[model samples]
Target: MTSKKSITRRLTLLFVTASSVVLLALGFVIASSVGKHFEEQDMEVLTGKMALAGHTLEQLKSQNDLERITHLLDNSLVGHHGLEVLILRPNHEVIFATPNANFPIELVSVSAAQNSRRPITWTQGEQTFRGIAAELPTGISERSRVIVAVALDIAHHQAFMRSFLQTLWIFVAGAAALTGFLGWAAARRGLAPLRALREQAQVVTAQQLSHRLSVESAPVELAELAHSLNEMLARLEEAFHRLSDFSSDIAHELRTPVSNLMTQTQVALSRQRSADDYRSILESNSEEFEHMARMISDMLLLAKAENGLVVPTREAVDLAAEVLALFDYYDAVTEEKRLNLALEGNAEVSADRLMLRRALGNLLSNAVRHSAANTTVYVRISASLDAVSICMENTGDGIAQEYLERVFDRFFRVDPSRQRSSEGTGLGLAITKSIVLAHGGTISVESIDGTTTFTIILPRAP
Candidate 1:
């Protein structure tokens, strides 16, 4: 696997590369411009000297005037150091030449033939010169035009340019290093908020899930990520709290039944009871065991549902029919309590038959158990375009406002003082919620004016 570079290092490298490219480009332009300037200055001096030589040759009337022309040319060269001039006839015979300044024969021949004024550079031994050549007319009609070449030594300029280039590259290297350091520092400072967020997250454990990352202090680009992380932490904290509560509730629920069984057995064993008395105690103990078995089964079902393992078998289930069936099943209890079962409206939903029946049964049982005598337990079904709603409302002491959200939580009860040995396991509402969710539905509750309402919404049949 390829190792990834840190943001700081990547940014620094990019900065260095960009700066180096720009600096090198500027340096190249500068070097080229400076070299051209030196060539231009040298060409100016060489051209001027050639012009003077041409003027002297133009004054030549005959062979007699040649000596005076050469003398005048030699005198004109005076204090012009590092300058050389060569004049040649059409026969390639030298008319005048600088002593010991032997310009190359090839350069003279090529420049004379081309008659170009553009400067050319050539090196001789330890010296470099820029020179130009032109054809000039003589005063004598019998003689042909003369070729005049002029050169200027540019060794000092070359030396200066070489040093300048060396200094420029060194400066660019140093600048790139400095820019890289500054870029790394800037990148590190820019990412400081992420480090802080990570540090805050690192301290978060199951026990410390309540810790939240600050979104306000984060950079705009990372603000959304921080907000999402905070939301996740909030969910984790709530889940952890629920898990803690579930652990305590399960232990408490199981302890009572086990303690009852143990106490009953101990009392029965201590005193030799008759066969009927022993049988009665065993029968009573069986009830507690059955209750425990039901609670454990409900918890297992809830666990399966939570893990998305409860795949409901899809079928069309009638809401009114299920409620009527549950009412008949609980007829004795409802009749004994003198409570009325009033169901209105009818809707159909596509759901698992047994699961749907179980959910409705749990809600109806709760409604019956909690309803005040002579008050009606209402089951209302309503249908919309895409969904069906079934509401179970009971006339009883309503649940508190704070507990509405947690009512469907496992083992949660409106009355904490309610005995664990109550007829139904506390997991009924939780199981109902899980079943409804398994069928891709939602369950909600609201209490108002001494009436408690539990609503289940499922997708309507296609």
Candidate 2:
């Protein structure tokens, strides 16, 4: 299993990593731009010095005087501090060289025909220099030529750049640290709503399910989550109440029969009785046992159905046949009440034959029991291309509107009184609904105008 991690840490890491990448890229671009600007400035300075040397050489051609050129070079070197000048003849002879100047021969060897001007960098001892070399015409003879070399000290520039880069990196590191700290703080602050939600959720218990998340107060990003959590709480509360009621109803239903069996047995045992009296008492106890058994059996069946253990056999079942069979079974009860049993419409559905019969029997039994005397208990089945609907409608003092929705709930009764009568174990409709649901169908009940209809709709067999 994957381990859980804190959302705050994840967000902090993301923010810090992104900021670091951006800062690093920006730092690189700025460093490169500054370096290029300094290099260009150095090249311009070197080019100007080369131009000055060429002008001084041009003035010497009119005199054809080497001494005059030497004097001018010395003066130029003295006037411009940190400047080096070297003058070479066409025969590779060094005509003039400034004090402490050691210009590279390679620079002097460069022919004007090959390249008019060339800039180069050279290091002497501990200092670095940038210089340019140009071959100039003497105007005295066709073979007479002068190579002028000029260089500027760039050691200070190098030192400044090194210091600038060190400082830039230091500032970049500081900025990254500051940004990461700020990002972590912002991430934590931004997720305060989620923290509140967690605290609220942690406090929730079964008894506190009625409490709901405050959607309106939540951030927009978390509103949907809050609403979903609230909805889940509502469902949990509803299920909890249903389970509580089911427990109470089960205990109430079982207690009566058990208490009666215990009382009757104790009374019968209290005094010696005739065999017939004892047999009668035993029969009464048997009846109570039978009721308890039926209730337990119904509860078991409902549990199986809910747990998806009721796998029904697929078979074509005739609805009318099932209705007629139930009518015959409940014939005595119906006749005593002077009720009429009517079967209308016809449809065949794919379902377990025994389950179908049981479902219809329950519906008919309920109809006959609740229905008024001389009223008709109508069983109707309608078929469509995809589904078949079975409606068991009865004319009687109909169920109240409030109880209609929960009529099929196990051990539920329209009369809240827990009196043990010939009515039922209060699981008849619940069993009917469970059976119908197992067959990929739905069962619903509605009452209106002294008429209640329980409708079962099942998918038609292909």
Candidate 3:
């Protein structure tokens, strides 16, 4: 496979190629125009010279005046270098010729009538020539016809054009090279912002996720990139903080039970004890073990839920039946707290039966634990065309505004001191949330006017 090229090199090559093509095209056009211009100029000169020679022939009074005509031709041809003149008689014998003139005989043979001219081009050795031939009327006799030829050398003009084209090619190549260099330089300069972004990104780590790209200072084209990178950094930073907090909370929660078990075991083994005492110590240790086991189980369940490993079997679950079952389970605790439990309204939701039951049990348990004495804990279910909603409200000292949002977070509690009278692991609400989410539902909590309400909404069965 071939390696990819950089944008700078690509742009530079593009610029050079385009410039070279344009320059070559322009050169061809100019060269053709110049060649045509020279041909036209030479043709005009040759035509005039032919006309002059014909007029001189017409002015001759008789055939005996040929000498005067020759003299006139020689005088007219003076000071005109590279110009050749020749006069032929009716029998094609040269009658007059300029000194050193070597006009082609073929030019005289291809003759035109009097007052008419024909132009022709021929080359001799290294010299190219353009000329015109015309038949002239000699006044000496009716049978005396004179053919006049006038030619101009074009070798110098052809040489000039060759030199011009060579120079033009050299200039075009130089301009293309210079343009390529400039294009590369401009591309590099324009990409400074991207380079800066890369450098900034290189410095970022898990510990330094707070650093953000300066979007406002970036070029308009790169501003969106910078903003998106900054937003990603913000999310990574929040996730990092959450990970750190999760680690700390897990350590704290586990340490309590483990430490308690260790201290109690050490106390029991401090001296010889009766079988009842040993059994009682073992039972106490068993409670702490159970608590730690519950915490670990809840953590595993949450992890599986979050990773989409928990696939719930959907079924029609009656909300009232689930609430009644939970009330039965928590009857002893509610009776001790003198809290009354009430279930109102009925709805069926599309959910996993076991998962829904567990979620409602957790919510009811939490409400009963927090409700004031003799206060009623209410479970209200409602249904719409497409969804079912369950609201669990309990009368108590409501949660603080700040803690309401995080009440469903794992191990979070409104009580900052974490003091608990019940055998709760602080994962009840968190488990409820995970179960609800696994069933394609949402759970939210709000506390107002000495009342805390937990709401769960699930899609209705089709």
Best by TM-score: 2
**For residue 83, what is the lDDT in candidate 3?**
86
lDDT per prediction?
A: 0.87, 0.83, 0.83
Candidate numbers sorted by TM-score from highest down = 2, 1, 3
Candidate 3 residues 189-210, lDDT tens each?
9888889989988999987898
Deviation in Å, model 3, residue 220 alpha carbon: 1.0
- Model 2 Cα lDDT, one tens digit per residue, 82-201: 777777876768888777676777755763335556567888788787777777766565666787777777788788888988998888888878887888899899999999999989
Model 3 Cα RMSD, 1 decimal: 5.3
* lDDT-better candidate, 1 vs 3: 1
- Per-residue lDDT of 51-162 in model 1, one digit per residue for the tens? 8888888888887787567688889999998888888776778888888566776678788788878887888898988888878888876455887888888889989999
Error of 2 at 213 (Å): 1.7
In terms of lDDT, model 2 sits at 0.83
The pairs that clash in candidate 3 are none
| Colliding residue pairs in candidate 1 | none
Q: Find the candidate with the highest lDDT and give its number.
A: 1
